[model samples]
Target: MSISLSIHGAAHTVTGSCYLLQSGRTRFLIDCGMFQGSKTLKALNYGDFPFKPEEIDFVLLTHAHIDHSGLIPKLVKHGFAGPIYATHGTIDLLSCMLPDSAHIQEMEVSQLNRRNVRRGRPEVTPIYTVQDAESALRAFSPVTYDEWIEPAEGVRARFWNAGHILGSASIEIELTTGLDSPRLMRLLFSGDIGPEVTSFHPVPESPQGLDYVICESTYGARERPQMTLASRRDLLAAEANDALKDNGVLIIPSFAVERTQELLSDLLALAKERRIPRAPIFLDSPLAIRATEVFMDHADELEDGEAFRHAMRSPLLRTTESAQESRMIERIDGSHIIVAASGMCDAGRIRHHLKNHLWRANATVLMVGYQAEGSLGRILQNGTRAVRIQGDEVKVRARIRTLDIFSGHADGTALTQWIEDRGPVSRGIILVHGEEEGLTALHDRLAKKGLDGDRIFAPELDAVFDLLAESPSKRERPAPRRLQPEVVGQLDWHNDLSRLWLDIEEELEKAADDKARRVVLRRIRRALENERS
Candidate 1:
């Protein structure tokens, strides 16, 4: 029997994690995630899936992060009717997250259609609706950690705690290859490994001794300083104290799931200790508020569970559920904290808050999550003097601060250690879910550690491989890809155009007189004409 594996997403970039495996007569997917990052990547979210959805047997979800599980509703909307196997915690989070994702798309598309109408362009529809997300919810089948299950004939799989989020997991599979000889092939998919020390869970764990292992390299090129819980909280308290001084609004663009809850717990702890002022902290995103409730329900499984529960219920923590309430936050007059979602500031209420407060020198934007390349958050982090937000150019006078201590993924050193712990693999290690920098760094690090360089495979998007018993072999492309592998993580032309426009405006403003400005404009026009010719 021949078994083949295909990289659908998260191969050359850190978003849209998916893998398709085909064995004998069975075909299944590891994850059916949505694409996030540059416009070129996000465009894939609206395009057709490379494979037929109806032919997929089932889906094995890694976690509830939109980058990993966002496109499930779209899959269901198309024709997939198979059950989605996930942990109970993942299911609970997805129950709210999927619908929230659909609603956001619906709202954004509706607003976009209005603009399109004025421009006389064709109307565009959302990829999936709230009803479609509701329909997808019915297909979830919960499973427990460390339990083995057979989703198809000759296939046995088990889930291990990845410790990245509330219910994140790394999957292990055992496949029967030869019926007469009765041979077994083992593979492990390391879904986003977490740091060694975190407030919510323990270090990531998984079984060793596999034929082939697929690992995520989200932070494979960067290394973070080791920090204990108290130390991490101390850093947060300091940042919060400094930002809240002189009646400033501290805006933390946070992830809705685990990151928000973790920050809330730490902030409340600091306030109780009198380390930071007990300013009213507003949870402004409806999706984050709902996710926090799920965290509260599962507090018993976390470290310092009682403290987390207590922190979540504190009077200083105010959750704004309605759009009107969220808008009302801008009218407040005192120093406070606002925790909003879409951590990368690519979408959600964070954009609205940034637009309202970015021009104010008294405001501070504390980024607590990883910002992908070309994301609005990255653009700000790069110190752009002015940014285009929601069709308005906003001057960036607000202070931008980044706290790397709050990342959910393990860093380079920790990722190397995690891979070392999953030892003695006979076949190969396939690296995915990262950009070229991360993938190359991890590969070199592994090679320096005496692992054969040839055994480490970093496949591009849509690349196929024949998963042989001895070693996996890369196969020729069966079809052309939706995107070139080179364009996966880099800034697209849209980002370039935005930067170019900003430069032109800055040059015009710098001109001494109208004549000088006209000269600059004439030169630009000549350049454009030359390019056209």
Candidate 2:
């Protein structure tokens, strides 16, 4: 018997969430995601999987966010025929999201390949296609809240409403794995906990004592996120009023899922109350329009969704067609708000709007979501007055503003409060899903109170730790960039056939005969030949 956990992704960085757990011969993986952000990291999207895809037994998804679920199509293409577990709502969102992600991949990869051709370099390909995404969608297995869904022989799991997003869940897992027998252990995975006490949903209960808990710290070091739903409501009203005075466009870059819905609902309330001057609001991005509709379908998950009990209210101003998006952008009247997707301003119609509006002093640019480093949104957030959009240098004269309210993640104080409420239990703590600075801040704060003996650990990318397996003779793990010698040979870095002899010698040391070892060597050489030509 053995127990091991491998951090496949989302260790040092925020995106590409994945981890593998093993008990005896059965292997389970959680959150197979695509990496986003910088080019170097983005290339991980095209990497050869560390393990054989066919060997994977199951996949547990956290939600439908691209960073958390975008790689599913690639997994399916690689021959993974396992059950992909998620909530019903997540399934709906994925139905909309996965196809869109593939579309973006195609657009981006084709552009990159064009540049590669110009530079006399090898052309890269999209990891998967739209058809692959369709195939992957067929593998979804939906589970409800508080229901135990067993994955393997010794693992029992259940999902709780995390209130982070529609159908987002915090999972509780019980694993019984022993070096020689069965030993019980409890584990909890926080699936992107929500904005505390927002206008739409109530904050969920802090998951309590367990043998081990894997909690996310997305905002572990920040102060209450600097915004709330109440403040955001007021801000929206005030901004709309100000923009009405000037009669200019208000461009909002928002995530397609919950954030877009929250903004629309807030705007709808303002429209009903006449709190601000009335103007036609544009809900651009067909994907967002579809997502908002899906959100409304899940009224049972919303707190104010019950407000419909008093009187039925429309959720968001969903523009159904691309023509609507174009018509609004082309001929928008004074001071109207326009919301679009690819929240980072890195892509989408927002780019067109920024090019159209950024130079005007009367126009306003409002940011609502967390912009990762290197995105156009971050440049705007950092107070850059001018930036490039679509290869053109554009001046930024619009009054840049931010209302970080409507966060779906719990902040530092909330993380602390949740931890304290969980009562004294096991001391071992593993901090995940945070930047280095944020994780350090939380670690120091927890250190002061001595909760659970401060066994806090933030594992490195690809780090391996075995809690139940006996420590083997100390051997350094291979670097991630180094896969098989065949992969290395494909680079044409080693022309000599015997270049890999030493490593092969060590690898086949325990073989019974030289004949068997030579066969293995021949197979590796053949694989190298395939990759090269």
Candidate 3:
């Protein structure tokens, strides 16, 4: 009787979190998250699962974040029919999130196909449709936090509140071979643990007695400011006041889940006290509006219930649902705050808003969450003078501000303390859900605390940890597989050149006449020749 853990995704990257645990005759998955960020990483979403999804017994979801649960629909579409277990809050969030994700895919593919038709290229189908997402929702089985359950043979599992988002959790699983076997293994998967205290969600509880722990290191190398939620709110109010004084549009690219609710709560407080002007506050993403309702439904379970109620009832918070309503927002002429999704600004209505307002000197773009490398938000955060949005280069004259207090993940100090609280154990501590540098920093920190080098693993993508079959003391470090010769991404010249050529082709297709098309081509050719010179 042996158990093995396979790292499918989020091994050394911040997104696409999937893990497979095979215990004796039973097989199950913890997460089936979608790959996001770079084109190379996002391209992995189109590839087949390394293992057959139908063979898995069940899925144990840790949260409802798209990066953690986004690929569940794809799994179901690929023939996985087992129950997908999660907390009630996560289940409820998924009810809307999955459908929204599917809708985004539908919209993106529709746009891409239109271009493909014009260019005589083959049309591509969406990875999964809205119907597939709806079908996936039927498989959810809600479980209560802090209760143990046997979802499959020889496996017992429990969920603890992780304080990351609404109903987010860290899962603990114990597996035993048989009554005669002396071997019993326990594994803990930290599903995006949050800070010590959050205004929106309750603080997470640290669990002990784990033989092996799989933890996240998203902020393993950075420390957050020691500020209370009230102070953070004060800062937000100051920013709003400044934006209002400038008489410019305030744009916020916010996550559609917990971050939206938190921001709304603070804004509602500001509105009550008249700290901000009586301007229209638009919640532009329909997905966010639905998620806010879910937050409202679970208000009693949150930390600041009264605040949540006040935020939900705010009259200034307007929601735009239809295409016409969204378009109408672009035409409005006034000092207002618009919160849109695809938090990183890679997709969604935020791109449209950024295109319309980013060039205005009076506009302000407030970034409120983690922006992965190569994301448009990161580009703005890095102080890029201009950015390409939906095929047009937009000058970034608008002020870009990042409020780190809104982040849900715990920082370096909090993460270290969480790891230390686990008590002394001679077992493996596997790091995932972070970039290489952050993971290395965390691994070094753990080593300084007396954890042996052999016991600490920073797994590469697709690396496997054979838990039951091999002891940490005897197991050798896993080598990374050759996925490619070198990393290919937004900075890769080949990728950039291809994209530039595609943009030129699209612009030519939209030209009114051959003269205009020739003008476009000549400009491109001249630009290339100038670059060569």
Q: Which candidate leads in TM-score?
A: 1
Which pairs clash (backbone N, Cα, C closer than 3 Å) in model 3? none
lDDT of 3 by residue, 380-458 (tens): 8988766777666777889899888888999887887888787554478889898776788888888888778788887
- Rank by lDDT, descending? 1, 3, 2
lDDT values, one for every candidate: 0.91, 0.73, 0.84
- The TM-score values for the models, in the order shown, are 0.98, 0.83, 0.91
- What does candidate 1's lDDT look like per residue over 268-354, in tens digits? 889988899989999999999999889889988887778888888899999999999999998888899999988999989999999
- Model 2 accuracy (lDDT, Cα): 0.73
The residue-level lDDT of candidate 1 at 259 comes to 91
Residue lDDT tens for model 2, 424-475:
5363566676666667777777777776333666766676656442222211
lDDT at 159, model 2? 83
Q: Better model by TM-score, 1 or 3?
A: 1
- Tell me the deviation in Å of residue 306 in model 3: 2.9
Pull out the clashing pairs in model 1.
none
